[model samples]
Target: MFAENKLTEDFGDIRNFLLSEREKTLSEAEWRFRMRGYGYNLKRVDTGYEVARMTTQQVIGTLDL
Candidate 1:
């Protein structure tokens, strides 16, 4: 199933489910912050998924952590 909500830009309440369930679920705000801060985010590729650097568009592979 496709989730249309994920496409929205609203960074929902930080003190709600996101903050409380970070260990189980990664919120949009947290991922965006970490991705931009580290210059990378998980990207979907033809083969699968990868950790790509935004500025250079380089696929740096996946990370388990």
Candidate 2:
């Protein structure tokens, strides 16, 4: 995330770099909300993303039978 091509020492101190990352990086909630537009309701756990598609009413109704 701190690669030279992305953020070099010329940018300034580490604190400023981290602040910039915070501004640029999306939170987990933001990611989930964005993914939903493409038909995915995912979540981040531990170190990876997982879809909780079963929670949708369509899925639940389909599985009810």
Candidate 3:
């Protein structure tokens, strides 16, 4: 659920934000399970959660984009 034409730089910042907040925002197990659903296995180190990239496509063909 991101806006169109949002720069890759902006996305990178968002990922950084999530990674920085994982522990403060979610329990370790909760964060791990959530990330694992998207195929990211997180390890608890000095950082909260490592960011993983997933390429998702918009289904605009049926929405008349």
Q: Pick the candidate with the highest TM-score.
A: 1
lDDT by residue for model 2 over 37-60, one digit each (tens)? 534444445645444342362321
Task: Output the better candidate (1/2) by lDDT.
Answer: 1
Model 1 pairs whose backbones collide = none
Model 3 lDDT vs. the true structure? 0.44
lDDT of 2 at 35: 41
| TM-score on alpha carbons, each prediction | 0.38, 0.34, 0.37
In angstroms, the error of model 2 at 43 is: 2.6
TM-score sort, best first = 1, 3, 2
lDDT winner between candidates 2 and 3: 3
Question: Could you report the Cα RMSD, in angstroms, for every candidate shown?
Answer: 12.2, 14.8, 11.7
C-alpha lDDT of residue 58 in model 2: 34
Error of 2 at 20 (Å): 18
User: In every candidate, how many clashes are there?
Assistant: 0, 0, 0
Q: Would you list the clashing residue pairs of candidate 3?
A: none
Candidate 1 or 2, higher TM-score? 1
TM-score for model 1? 0.38
